[model samples]
Target: MPIDIRGSSASEIADSLRALVERGGLRPGDALPPVRTLAESLGVNRNTVSAAYRQLTIAGLVVTLGRGGTRIAGQAPVAQEGFADTVLRDVGTGNPDPSFIPDPSRALATIAGRPILYGEPVIDPDLERWAQEWMSADLEPASLRLTITSGAADAVERLLAQALTREDAVALEDPCFLASIHTVRMGGYRAVPVPVDEEGMTVDGLRAALAHGVRAIVCTPRAQNPTGASLSAQRAAALREVLGEHPYVLVIEDDHYSMLSRTDYHSLIGPEHRRWALVRSVSKFLGPDMCLAVTASDPETAQRLALRLTPGTTWVSHLLQRLAHALVTDPDARDRVDAAAEHYAARNAAFAELLTAAGIPVRAQDGLNLWVTLPVPARAVSEQLMRRGWLARTGDEFDLVPAGPSHRLRLTVHDLSDDDAGQLAADIAASVRAVA
Candidate 1:
């Protein structure tokens, strides 16, 4: 059996490959012909083959493994989190320290309820009321509607499902949230890379993505993952202006860190944007087990999302929703959440200062993890750190493109004590210097 590339153009080659994949001729993990061999056999330019391969990669259909060559991507990789299962110091897990998460035992006891029948309202009244106030405080004047889902990831999946079709182009940060990357790739959508800087997603990047005809844009306005970059007020306003021209394109702001973020929420959803969703999950502030997120969006989007989460078949559990409401409203719980927020900021900042002193010059802008730029490629540095009995996440894990080797690492060292932080910083500096 051979690939039919006789008179195919770049996109035609991509289409043929996609069809083969769909029909099961080319299985996951199956190897494609080498680029030079395929090009020569097909009587096509090598650049055309390269472009076709690039398309396949963007569509999440195949992956290039350096000298290992290209192979069909088996399945969407589960975004690893909060520590890999290993003996080394687990700094890669982007999870909040268990000690900082407030105990939900009391809230569990308070959630007394009768059996929730299929016809009952999906969202708890109390939870809805609280969410309205919480979301309204940050939004500009608009006709908004509320919807609840299992978590931010669930909300994003549903939002995209309702608004776009498979194979639609979606704009995502280059080094993006794992969940976002996983969601887009698993949905079989084309991911367009938008670069991020210290201030946040770049205006030019967004413009380029929009120019490429992206149907939806997923943005992390504050406490962006991996990099800890937050959208500054100026940056947000500039993005809003660029987006003003594309009012109908769907914009999803995943404010997953929400109350736990030290930076202010600078939203990218402009007032005139017709289709949008702002999702805030309680997992970070309250606890991951709570499994509830509040989404405020245009009424039309809310109505569409509701159709997917009807009462009987797939609504989020009312018990979970009520417990989340109870804990969030409790004064003690609120105070503890606030304290946890402060603690994360302080710990990350302190560790960053130590790294800077060691000549690494890293700073944690915001979020539970610190994104450290290494003097060498992050993978090499991470390998050296492993020799030192430390584990960390390299930035390449979050990239949307196979651009090059990553030069950064995402670390969850905030849970370490001051002495441990100093030692880790020294180890990291040494590892980088060694690798370089």
Candidate 2:
């Protein structure tokens, strides 16, 4: 059998090769037919084939060798002509796996009414009541009040608006959530650094930041993003001890992974605190498209956050509230959500085991991703992984305000099979070796 290359221009030849790739004929690293033979079969000049090969090489579709032959490139970037590219396998961000997001089509079909109008209470009645109960249970206090927001980021933004003004200093865990880092920078407020370790944000770091005049703080109590670190009871107590005198500074606990979290939640905001909040977004467990998060805060801060979430300005859609309530209350979706949580935990642990076997240490205490302590620079490791048919994200992206030097990586293995995890581990070992 012969490949039929029929008088195709360079672009046409490229498209044909791309189709071959999609159809699985030209697998990663598989050699293409010789240029001369392809040219003769297509009844075209050799330069036409040559041009096609050159463009493909530049485009990363094929790789040329001295004599072994030009082969289909492995782990090429998805061509970005116009469409938005998905950041696949990067696991750098704290996004849930596609397989884990609940199918909302069925739920959407059940909504049988007109679209909502502004100036009305934007949350479904049943959902509003249910969310209040859940928040009350999770963050029990005498002055607790609930306010629904679009999502975690929206909650953070609104909280910031109510709590601070331009140039106000806020303490943040060093290498905090990326959105938190960006939010502080974009809002023109100063971000004071509070270091985090295996236990979580350090007491010394917090005290230092507070001493420097920080008025607000964002703390991830469980499953802190990127690092997968959580505040332990001992660390939380120590933090509380240090903050005993600093009761005026507002604390926002972004427990984004609350329900899906593998660890118990701990808060630095003691029972005596006059002002604080606990925010949990349904995006992770209930599907990011759910676009809803509930914030529990003291009455004073809650009133402020509610004011920020004003009727038409930023109220979360009531329809989304209904869907969330329906799905969460449904036994089937609740069970599925629980199973998904366990699945992600098991997958991330398994991936960490493989990494350990490959001699690269990593672990995840409570989050969907593993915090890998690479033996070398993460950028070097990531670049090498790209060569081995994998693209991993570097840790630098999440550093709130990166300090001296750090060599680490945050990888999500939610959708990775055991086979892919093993291959990824092997690549990581090889990448580390190359960097060494």
Candidate 3:
């Protein structure tokens, strides 16, 4: 059956197509008529049909495959960064151990104050001052402006939205953070895969992405997700040199694991770089419920980002901001945070030893999880582990561009007991051999 695309105006046509999707008249993978065919049938101009298609694509209702034509988007669920719902032991959950997170009770008591009214400053003054000093240590003494958002993910989404329009190309790390992938796809932006190696985004991969005409780049400077790769000083300098050719490209460095990361920060932003933002969130140390992140960016980018974050409507709550500041500033809470970093590193290191002893040679890196390379395909070993009551996240789930079968597994084993960790290591070794 043909799609009855009925309407004279762009808005009307978009509404008509949306209705078809809502009513199940058009299903996922169902292709819409060509622009000329739809325009001729509806007695409208080709521009009107094109506008309608653009509207649907931006709304994530349809996908344009260029010469292949537009089709209804499948709406597949994007994988998240937290715990997975499972009865089995979930080693794939990219979560900080609860015991390590600092207690918020003391800070909560100190945050009570007069209710903030609309039109008052968006960011808490104390928080703003502290954040400036914190970010300044890592950044050059340029004209830096600060903006606070709900979290690092929210900051990235808004930063990209302010910088680029729909279909604009963005350079993303291949095997990227799940949230970044979802944000780019939902905004209808093209993601140019920049491969990440042990030292972070490869210089050649970044050059290729730039050559592909990417308008923006999102990279994790330290403790990169899944792979736990950090940019070494040498690699960071090389990346900065490559980016020098495209100084105006919007570079967003999501330093999400800021406080908890054991590695030193190696910045990709050069002293003379024109556009960039470094985002650090309080979620990892203060607990995920403390939804706040501080972003330091070039003055102009900060101004553009502020447009989306209004005084009262969209600005992050001042109370939350104060709470985060109090916790971070307190000596006891700061000590707890430092301990948490050490705790995570030690746990991961111990687990790596366990894996090595079990016949699978492994080395621990930064971040809360271990990115293990298996002798066999990760999916096959994952399946074998599933039979032994364990849930695992394979490397393919994070791949921006599907290569062949992935041989890596991202395991969150930091919170497991010593016995459990040893058992899991042995089980993983068995699973690899079983699937080999």
Candidate 4:
């Protein structure tokens, strides 16, 4: 079906396209007419058509695939949780152990009042006061402003929407976070892969990405997903040096595992850097259901983020904010959260040790999961594991660049007991050997 934008402005055109997508007229992968062609047909300037296309792209309604033309953005794959099977030993689900999650009963009791209405302050005062101190301690001495979003993913989505255009290159860690990959692809932005090692994101990889004129860079500072890598101070300094040359490019540090992480916060943003946002989500520490994250950023970036999250627009729930505040500020709850962090570290470390004993070396320095490299392809090993009643996630699923050989697997078996861990490790080694 052809798009009919006879007397429409850029916004109207974009709205029409969005409606088309909703009505199933424009399906995913369906190509749109060229900007020049559409402009000529609609009797509008080419810039107007381009602007409309840009709006659709930012809204994740369409993608501008160079040479191949504009098309509807493909749907992002959902991250899988534990398998709902009684028999399968589910280790693939990237979830924190349920026992570690603090019970919010007491925190719920502490939350008072419900006079929240439109035009009120978006962030809860109590939450803001506590979050300000929390974010301030981790950040370099600078004029930082804070904004609350639904989660780290929400913060990332809003930041990119405000800062970038369709087809703009955004740097991502090679073995990227599923949410980050999904958000970038769904937004119709180009994702440039930056390699990550045990020391976190490589400097040369970032330098190369910057050289290619990436508009933004999204990095996981510690406990990087699919690899469990953390940025050492030396690595952070090196990355900061590379980023110093490109200070204008937006730098987004997703410190998602902040409290749960065993490592210190090694920042990629230097003090002099202009556009940057440090996002810390309580999802890992506080339960995922809390759905709140604090984004500490430069005044300008914070202001732009605020614009997207105005009073009635996209503000996070004040009740939830108050609850999160209660948990973080309450002495007993804070201690429980601290203990939960240590629990995850100990469990993951223990599992990694087991894998090593089984002769299948794993590097799980921090975080809830281990990233183990197999001598054989991950897919074949995953199939073998399934036969042995174990479900595991293949590293290929997390690769930013598809079409490459993948030999790694991400396992979240932190809750497994000594016997279970040993058996699983043995099974994994056997699977790899069988596949090879």
Candidate 5:
């Protein structure tokens, strides 16, 4: 057969050619028909046919050997330009809106400690007692134990180090927090991406991951990155059901936005699930520089994690811990922090509303940012925004699987003033339209 090439446009024709290649009819060295003949046969304009052919050539799927006609190449198409160290922006990162974080002066007032001698335990007893209380909220099970660490990122690294080997597969949300993905690459581990949905990690994706023999999973149950999808209570229960049968799999829950999260905690770790850790970092609400995360896990796993902490880096900063404890426990600080969480949620929602009003689709469940769908490629839109004097991160940078052209963009709406947000909305609308 001459390869079925019926499709809507130039891109579709290119896709049809790829399909032929996949079906084995268009193997290496298989020369395609002349452009004019193919265009006539398909009832499309010759320029449309030419564009498709050019695209296929660019993809390396076909090569025009001078007048010898186009032949399938040994390789496939090259991926178009991808994330090149995405620019830091006023948008994208899911950090707490700084205005809401309470400045804790009391911790500094009590800060007085000499360098510890060798073999000294790392954590402060006072902080430990308070952490036990602080951690109790997220990890409600009495059997679960708690340990302090530098941050949620640190906790993830140490847990992965303890459980998996070099190059072992670990499942993570495809558009996960960059840190977790970076942790996998930096630790020389292969990442098995589980697709996320509006309710966070999909069950089928999880099943595929388990079947793929992923020994570790890093999930952010609530406030998942990029997409801002939180796992529903029912979804959490379903995941726990699947995980229950896999006792040996190490589940790490990174609740990085704990204090700033306006959602309830949900866990895929069943009551009987043996190995798991719920990492709640105070860095978000308390401030990133605070650098302390409460790592709560099962007693045995917590002890193993403690061993990783060791005598040298024995525990988290006692000063940081004390600060976290004081701030979390203080009524005024707690109120301010809660208000900050609400502030982030409100700002994101308002921005999403503004975008929608401007004909740009957007929705974010509960997070420091909003996921927006534009009318054209988000990367192009972000580049335009950069020219407009606002740096923005392209969502493609955080996605694991390659997404075809999309208008999706993640906007960190927190910290934007009314005027700034209005201006951003107007600019973004103009940019998307310009690209489209």
Candidate 6:
């Protein structure tokens, strides 16, 4: 059955289309008529039809796929970060080992204080002080302002919301972090993919994205997800030079693996850049339940971000902030965090050696997961592993371009025991050979 769209004006047409979607007259992936055709049928100007499409696009009721034409937006599932639900030996979970997380019990006692009232400061004073010193080490102290959010994901979402409007272009890593991809799509912003290599986002890729008129760039300086790529100092410098020309572009650096990373932090935000933010979350070190991240940005951006975090309604729980501050600052807790970092690096290195010996050569990088390149498609290898009593995540799930089957796998083997790790390595080798 054809969609019975009925309207004369843009608002009327948009309302009609929305009603159709709500009533199931037009389903997801169902394309609307061409602008000229729709306008001719409705006896309206072509601009009127185009305006109607824009309204629907902004409302996220429909999607405009360039030459592919506007269609009802599909309700696709967003990829998540955490454990997969399965009885098989799950190695694809993008989670830090629970054993390595610092115990928050001692820190809990230290955070006991009077009940925080609505009129009180949004950020805990002690936490604010500590965050200032920490962020100031890398960001310019003279202009830095801090804001606290639920996590890095929250910060990025709000930052993009404040900096850009719907449908604005944002540059993201090609095999981007799941949260970033989801955030961009849900905000109705366009994502321009910037390719990543062993040294993080490529300079040429960034240049092309900027040339494409991207208003914002989300970068991972270290421990880039799935790939475990860190930004090399040389690459960072080159990126900075390119970004120097576009000082007004909003640059958000999510240093999610800050404390756990083995590499130095190389920022893409230049000192003279006008709008930028650096977000560092404690989830990787303190545990994910902590739900806290600190953002340092220029004074103006911080002020705009502050608008979304109202004092009485949207402020992060002071108790949570205090606990995070205590744990991150305590000597014993710091020691545990340091040991955890070492444990991750050591475990990943050992697993890499085992993989090499199993004929799948890989080198350990600075993240919780290993990005393994295989001889055959990763989905095929993953299926083979499942048959062998294992579960894994294929790389295509992380791709922004959707270029068909991927030859890579992201395995989280840090928590596995020596015996279990060795078995997994052998199984992966066997799976790859079977698929190849």
Candidate 5, residues 33-58: lDDT per residue as tens digits?
78888888888898988878876754
Residue 378 miss distance in model 3 (angstroms):
1.4
TM-score: model 6 vs. ground truth: 0.92
Between candidates 4 and 6, the TM-score winner: 6
lDDT per residue, candidate 2, 201-224, as tens digits?
998899899899998999998787
Instruction: Give the least accurate 10-residue stretch of model 3, judged by summed lDDT.
Output: 308-317
* lDDT value, residue 410 of candidate 5: 73
TM-score to true structure, per model: 0.89, 0.77, 0.90, 0.84, 0.77, 0.92
- Top-TM-score structure, candidate number: 6
Q: Model 3 has how many clashing residue pairs?
A: 0
Superposed on all Cα atoms, the candidates' RMSDs to the truth, in angstroms, are 3.8, 15.7, 3.2, 4.5, 12.1, 2.6
lDDT of 1 by residue, 1-436 (tens): 2865444698888888888888888888888899999988888999999989977886678989888899988876577666577889978888887888888889989898898986788889999999999998888747899999989988999899888876789999979998888888778688899999999899999999999999999999988998889999999999999999999999999998998988888999888899999999999988787788999999999999998776424778888888899989999989999999999999998898999999999877888999998878999999989998899899989987757899989999878987888889999999988977
Candidate with better lDDT, 1 vs 2: 1
Instruction: Give one clash count per candidate, in the order shown.
Output: 3, 1, 0, 0, 1, 0
Cα TM-score of candidate 4? 0.84
C-alpha lDDT of candidate 4 relative to the true structure: 0.86
* Per-residue C-alpha lDDT of model 3 across residues 198-311, encoded as one tens digit per residue: 999999999999999999999999899988999999999999999999989999999999988888899989989999999999888888888899999999999999997764
After superposition, which runs of candidate 1 have C-alpha atoms over 4 Å from their true positions?
A: 1-29, 32-61, 64-70, 74-76, 311-313
Clashes of 5: 1
| lDDT of model number 1 | 0.88
Model 4 lDDT per residue over 94-132, tens place = 887778788899889878797798778888999888889
- Cα-based RMSD of candidate 3: 3.2
Considering summed lDDT, which 10 consecutive residues are worst modelled in model 6? 307-316
